[model samples]
Target: MPETTPRGLAGLAFGGDYNPEQWPERVWDEDVRLMREAGVTMVSVGIFSWALLEPAPGTYDFGWLDRNLDLLHANGVRVDLGTPTVVPPAWFYRAHPEALPVAADGVRLEFGSRGAICHSNADYRAAAANITTRLAERYADHPALAMWHVHNEYGVPVSACYCDSCAAHFRRWLAREYGTVEAVNEAWGTAFWGQRYSCLEEINPPRRAATVGNPAQALDYRRFADATMRENFTAERDILHRLSPGVPVTTNFMTALSQCDSVDYWAWGRETDLVTNDHYLITDGRRTHVNLAMAADLTRSVAGGAPWLLLEHSTSGVNWQPRNPAKTPGQMARNSLAHVARGSEGAMFFQWRQSRRGAEKFHSAMVPHGGTDTRVWREVTELGAAVEALAPVGGTRTEADVAVLWDWQSWWAQNLDWRPSEDHDARERADAYYEALYDHHLTVDFAHPEADLSDHPLVVVPALYLMTEAAGRNLREYVENGGTLVVSYFSGIVDEHDAVHEGPHPGALRDVLGLTVEEFSPLLPGERVRLSGPGGAGLDADVWTEFVVPRGAETVWTYADGPAAGRPAVTRHRLGRGTAWYVSTRPGAEGLAALLGQAVEDAGITPRADLPRDVEVVRRTGESGTFLFVINHTAADTEVPLDTPGTELLTGERAAGRLAVPAGAVRVVRLGG
Candidate 1:
């Protein structure tokens, strides 16, 4: 086996999760043979094999793991060794029942699956650290070691705990944050509902209450839970860094999915050597490829535009969806290339081989239940070849002129009980904005509110209800320093502690936006207000509506017919050579497209190429040259016009002027000398 550099795997890693521990010793040989045939460069091992690695407490058994590592090394496959702290052995729970987490309703959650241990438990942390130390010591000098997978997806099953230990930890965390009981009360606005606490022990996790719980307290608890998970990850990561020097360490992130709301990837990215993410298709919506591109873009931004890894994705239909429909003929290849187009150095799936019996038996893998003769295996092999051909794209960066803000704290605050509308879903709102940009064939990157904004010409913030003072200052500075900003409805209404800002609605941003909201008139379900803008653009606004009186901003659009008719539905204010546009209502897809399109043109931003409808185009640049990825996501074939002449790596043909991209296909062209 050939070991890769300490930074990462040598070439584009084209392998998936390989659980050789689940099979017989004889099967390992067959797996390795197939790996070579499929061009697998790396494999993630021991993700959920804690019980097998350490059968008993303070006891170690490495004979099986040693054999598997040797076999993989002999087969020329690099290893992404997992610490196996995601799943605790049953004996662990039996010996230390105190490690179990309690639900919001005070019900002790029994562990029958992985990731059920409380993140704040002392025993669990100690045990996890011990295993990580042992693994790092044993594999530090191994020939096949490529990277260290710190832990499986954090906060997947159980994000927070309400146990006594966790409660105490929460009090200490709050004390460290607020300093005193009076400060905690002031931050939470506890005096409003006579819920003020005089001592640290009086506080606890947000449990069920008679009515809606305190929004500020709930927001703090969400932050505490995310921090606790980060603490757990850092503990193990520190041990690995000390024991195994020069080995890159990372934990897979679930980007933009529901499970990711509890953990902040913006903060987590600072701790990882390289960022990686697992994105599954949303079968119910049938727009899986679009969502995959969005996730990839966000993941790349989290890595600061560095090439990251696509750790997990389904080959075809996933078993978790209500209706698992397998991918169409060329859908698999299109899906994988989409990630690589957006700066992913590697393309990988959830598992290598299909499980015979388990919860994921129906889930598609590289080698499906039908074996290598099936279409799944054929597509997997073809994808491997395509990835190998795209080795030039490795270590490249994707360029985007626009950025959309993503904040977990705002997500928590917006969804908190007692809001303007029950349909205030943070993920859906952000996706709608991203989808509009994607439809226009414009590249985008996800930006944290507090991150540097000078790189992007235009920044779009959708439904950022809770804004920290620093984040608010950053946005203001961005606008004042000549950066265009687009803020949708229900943004900047509160500060970091979920406290409403004084003065007008949209609190801290009232000055920058040059508008004030007097009242909120939420629409009933299935109700909408007609909006008409300049240049014959019109659409219906649903979910929420705010009556805005512009003080300095000029009206760009107004409500046509509704209770809030003749009012400003959209406005734009110019400050310091930059523009700040605000949408006062939830505009439908067409309206958003029209408004965003105008914003792009106004900011002097140009798309990489003028693509046809449903055709996605992105550019990646490196020392070699610029690579243009044109993917036709539609069902019908389309001809994409390329501005620069270059060789198409997939077909070895010199392409220029116009290239025909087949339906559900992709073409990678290396442009420039």
Candidate 2:
């Protein structure tokens, strides 16, 4: 066996995607030398090299890869060998044109882009399996092999296909899931649309419809597409597990709220040997670091609080966004260490060298086109040394002070057509709630609706439109057991099948919230409402409002003016031993912070009020000791309170009482025993 060690690293795993094929053979020596200089321990190789690996059908070219792996191993760098199954070669596509994905409007997407394969096609599956098997067989015992990267970022670029092959595959999946055509019709609620199918053969993928398609049907197709992608992933993973016995297998996940929303990460989290995610900042004028922290926390939660890897991030700006502004000096290191503080084993970037020619030539890399003199190179080398200094913090887990409920399926349901208002975006609500908690300097762990909530002192349901009975019961039980809960509007209104819960609005949570929503009152564009209460004074809300009737709850805030003026806009209910707060309208940022502040007090959790704004503090504990990461995002120097004296990892200085962190810097302290 090559290596059974965790990610083939004794301490921290650090590096980027290494594409040796992109450069000349003479450059390989220099690349490895630079890698060693930067303290790179691992590099993901051959992720998009299918065309080069199998130039012609069934003709393999392992000479180049063999030499590359050998060279990496010689330099003491481990390899995350990829299966090369993401992008098929041109010859394979010419042979199987039907493998291309078709859009919802019946347009077949042409080749030339990555992730173009129709996952449901047999020919594509056979080709993928063959490539995966070939790579596994050849590198099973290679000394450089540490982990098997099955495919590069599944569900990106293309997820769902509307081709005929996918339609047939969808029918089979439905048959297995529903057992009968009648059951499918019932679950999909096809009776109202006059679209009930008598046989499974008559059904098809939710294709172009005259009007908006059935919400339930669209929802199921999302599930089916996600499962199909997983099927391909698991097939590749199984081949690697059998051929390469001790190596762990994983496919990178894009779990950020603004990124791929098709895959249910909770399910995918259970399938991988190790959970890894790729996060990029979407700089749209909002706080990018907050989104980074949220993505890192969500990824760690998906890993079941175990140490996960930051598989791929840009060293600076990304090319795909509308604006590709380069990061400021020292921002790269701060962004990287933030992830490490949230439970990432280490930080890795997109590519080792900035591409000279490609669709992503402008994308940032560790070694820019300016070579070793650029600011990016300086920060990259500095980050590498920083990672090495924090090796003692490896394997430690960050403890979360609160939990946020996140479900991709619920997000999918809310994003469908003909909703009350397009302004009611699920992703926006999630980001808002996470930002509120982050401003309070609270560490958050995202949980599935049905996951255990007993451990978290506080839980926030941002916006869950599709809630099953089990999840509702779970929340009720959690609150009854003394856990503080905060639920937002539009939650628990529908069941798993998109059917409205029978009786009152918010069907599943009416009892738990101690209030009933008689009707949804959505505001027109540019309209707003004022809220009045001790915590809600001068608060303005918009996008949505509800006519709430308090039953066994006390009114915390009332709509001072709007369509639902004087109605209970926010209510509080006391359950068995805990408290539940409900917000019936979207409040302004200050209002949200105030409401959450009350919930934190109710949970008996203290906020770090002494710390300045934008400074982040997180703790990671393990058998070695406790490590405190204080990241200063502000412009002025600030002092952070420390309970125990410890050695600062970065400067090798002994810190006691309180530590002064300079502006735009990160400090990791290894607490004394």
Candidate 3:
């Protein structure tokens, strides 16, 4: 679990969410002792320390915090100071009547529930800003300070937040985005049921339990909410940065969370600096790696294809789940290493110590079993020692030749479509393609839709259902500039307005893909069809079936033995100096692996061949030297042939192709060759 990470703050950041408030003053002594026991140098404090920070709006207390900071400073540990705006005192809520949020169901949220406030609420926003500025002014020169934590889980419980202020702002947001109420109504197809709005206030967000009848409106609402959250995040971030620019600022994002608040990268990434996200892989499973990799990639993408922190991973079982299954022995480290192998720059456990009582009292921790001499502590110590010895692995970076195209606009546009299908959800399909690439030992840079593609030679976008005219044109330019591209089925069916293109299914892409999808034949599970390569026997297509009428492209793969058999399942068309492959069906990972290998070869992308698929290699460049990280994820020990010679980062280790890496072992090698 090693890769080249970001410079400056990039070494093995050994710390996590910390709260000195929960323990007795005497217990803080043991905490310091344990910090040296493990290489724990950083602790994020004040995340939930709001109750202890200020007893009331007018009165504040830092007596406990001063001692906590003094302890960390004396111990030489850095602190990621958090602004306790998440859960303030009951006095603040009682006094600031506008602080509470009105849910979509029109009920003002009671205090106690986290994330139950409208960010647009003037009083709430001002209060949060006030808290951040005060904290910054107080801790600006604090030696224990390493970074600033804006707020704890900014987007949790984001499904609600339909306050009067939010509604008023939502109208303004819609006016700016859609230009006019009539345009908004038309895009939403308000005429379908006479839901047209004559004025902004006439429009109402659906209830907390409301059904998404109009996808266009629903999509816009989702976009507006995301934007609003970003605005709030930026407000807090600016306050912190102004107070202390040297302290890198960040807020933990939740993983691929359904709530739109965690959805948009372009909007919130600017303030986040280095993106960190919370992800809990509920149990030990093969799919866990894929999920963690996706989170790491998302974090990296926000950092502009750089490294990110695995901010919050449970040490064992968490408190809030349908079933709280504890992680098996070695599972926690295994999972954290998976994040490292995939591309997480730094790793930290969720809660340093278990909460003694309350909602998350049972959540796992680094010292769950006891104070210093327990299995969990031993495991943490072993991991820390391994990390310290593996110090050379620090600053190892991951570089990708190919990047998957991801766009919030596409995310918005697809959901805005009238035919936004529950059966063919595009987001899940795209995630599958990305994870497939990861499994193939291909380091893929997860990219925003409009992000620069000039650095990448091959771009894969699966099921991109929503295309604005500008985006389609940009894709054309990318292909014409000699970039190999892959566009899957159900793509380009609708424009930004959710209107069907006149000429064909893929309106602008028909020129690039050289084909048209007449209508999709939704094939269910266990559906059988053979997709063969010219006269090839036993070609496979198990999931989807489609009839392809090629306009100008050559058929590379075809389905067999079905009503749609003998039609093109995979087709390629030459556009400009490059080629475009359109996958008509969702193929298995094996099939996609084969397709990508051939496509990368066709695109002249260097694969670092003669290496095993289970073995991963990434090269990160620095001003002085370049670092190459090799990871072995396979069960059996394997030897990797390296072109590098005498490039040693470890003791008595030689850079040779025959270097043996045990199962789950990672090596940092320099590529002098």
Candidate 4:
């Protein structure tokens, strides 16, 4: 797929989320026996066994882990060793009492939750630093260690902090960010609530869910919390640099998770040796496919387009969500390819062996019901064999001229402040933007704030609510330098401070897009508006319907409902040599698909040609060859026809021109680059 990580394993490591730590000596033998039965080659260990790793504080224990490491390496399997920092031990919390987090409702955390480290607390940082340093020193040169797994999922905390450390840090962060308290007060518009603080110590996060009508400290608290967690990550990474300089380290990032601290994928990507993430979906397949693709895409884009480790996925199915669903007979096979079809090189599950007891006891695993011989094990073997068959084509890179900019800081900024419209989740919008491109066969590269767009032929920034002046300037140069630009609704509504723009909704893009959004209408489920299309046929609309007028841009599509009908719901303007398309509404899949198709077509983007919709396609470029992965998500059997002739990698299913794609199956096609 896209060369998300050039410095990755030789081929996709086919197994993940192993807890050899959870099993006994006999069970380890059983796991290895089963692993050999399958072609399983890699394992991610030491995720949440803090209690086991450190039975007691200050005294390190490596006996159980040493044996565990020796076994994996002996079995010819590489291990992604997790640093037991995900959950601090029971004794550490008991001793240094201030490590707990203060909830958003201002409740001081008792030792009740799992990820309980207070980000801004010095005691917590020093203790965490010491533990990581020690752990790295112990395991840096281990034969089985492929990557260092840092703390799990650092999402923006749900509840704000009231602790003195967080407060002081917030004051310092604000002071450096805005210069003085007066600028902050002005930006937050604190005069309305009489909540202005005389001293920084008096400031506190919202205890209750504050209304959007009243500007609360919740948004800033969320930012500060994310920032603080970042500080923690940097601290640990710096410590690891001293202990394990060669072993690349990273934490598993949950794509849409809000509870852990993340301003954007790139926020941690900078510190991480290699970005690794998890993609779990129990939702509807139609939409969930995009969700999976997006998770992979985000992972690929985070480290400036480096392929990420597909750390954890349910080999069979997931145990969370409204329903803990298992993958259908052919679903697991299809899902594995789905990751590959969207730029992922490796695939792994949450648990290689099933848990006998605990919360994830019901989670699917490769080692099924009765030890060594089972249907799950058979399927695992088959999938592993597939990876081995296609091994020569792995670790390739993809450079799409289309770059889709996605930022986590913008997500936090948008959801933090009060707005007059519907509640919009930043992650969902980001997914929608990415999916729009994917639906049209556009292999989109995820663009972070610092991403260089010069390599891309097109750049689409959807719902960019946190565009700093530099980011805006980047867009301007990209468009002026001949890149097709697309910006969706709520574009340029706010400055970097989460404050509104002065003249119009799209504050920064007036120079590039040549238009300003005066007013917009919130679209509920069925409500929609249409814009004039090719044959006077209008574009479909739903979600967010925006009203727009051009300063110099030309209208491509117009809204069909309310007083704002016929206005520019979609507008295009010529800037320098390239073009910009501003879509001011959250049009449904059809509309988004069409818009992306047209934008790419206009920009001279030659897609994989006319491939089937159910069959997802991806291309990875290497010095020797170009690899194309075609996956059929359909439940019915089908044949695959190629637009460009290529050699089949997996099935030897020749495509001297023609290839067959079985129902719920996949084929990895190779061509000379």
User: What are the models' TM-scores?
Assistant: 0.97, 0.99, 0.91, 0.91
Clashing pairs in 1: none
Q: Once superposed on the true structure, which residue ranges of model 3 sit more than 4 Å away at CA?
A: 1-10, 96-98, 208-212, 255-262, 282-284, 321-334, 337-344, 389-396, 412-421, 561-563, 606-613, 646-652
User: What does candidate 4's lDDT look like per residue over 44-128, in tens digits?
Assistant: 7877777776778767777888988898888888877776665778888888777687765667777645676777778767767
Instruction: Give the per-residue lDDT digits (tens) of candidate 2, residues 1-673.
Output: 3232345587788899999999999999999999999999999999999999999999989999999999999999999888888899999989999999999999999889899878999999999999999998888999898898888888888899999999999999998999999999899888986989989999888899888989998999999999999999999888988988889998899999456998999999988988999999998999999999999999999999999989999899999988899999889999999999999988989989989998999999999999998889989999999999999988899999999999999999999999998989889999999999999999999999999999999999999999999999999999999999999999999999999999998899988899899999999999999999974466899999999999898998999999899889989999999999999999988989999999999999988899888999999999889999999988888899899999999999999999989999999999983
lDDT per residue (tens digit) for residues 1-673 in model 3: 1112222343567767887788899988888888878777677889877767777775779889999999988987778788877776677788876778776667788888676667777887888888888788898888788777777776677534777777788888888987888788778778876677897778766555434466667667777777887787788888877877667788887746444334676666666776777788744344655666666666667776566677778877887767788876566666676566455655787778777877888888877746666677787877666455545545455677688877665666665434523456677777778766765667777776556787888889887777666667777788888988888777876676666666877775787788887767767666767678755744565555567889989999877667677688899888888888998877777777777777888778766666776666666654435656666666767877766664655344667656666777666665663
lDDT of 3 at 89: 68
Judging by lDDT, tell me the better candidate of 2 and 4: 2
lDDT of each: 0.87, 0.92, 0.72, 0.72
Q: Candidate 2: misplaced stretches above 4 Å?
A: 1-7
* Tens digits of per-residue lDDT for model 1, 1-673: 2112334466788899999877789888889999999989898999998998899988899899899989999988999899999889999999989899999999998868888989899999999999999999999889888899988999897899988899999999999999999999999999987999989889988898788888999999989999999999999888878888788888999977885678888889888887998988887664777788899999998888888889899899889767999988888888899999998888889899888977898999998889899999999888989999999888778888699998877888888888878886767888889888888888888888889999889999987998877888888889999898999988999998899898888897887898999998888898889998888777888988888999899999999987789999999999887889999888888888888888887678875445777788889998878999998988888888877989999999898899889888899999953
Give the CA lDDT, 0 to 100, for residue 609 in model 3.
Answer: 60
**Cα RMSDs of all predictions?**
2.0, 1.3, 3.6, 3.3
Error of 4 at 560 (Å): 3.8
Cα-lDDT of candidate 2? 0.92
Ranking by lDDT: 2, 1, 4, 3
For model 1, state the Cα shift of residue 105 in Å.
0.8
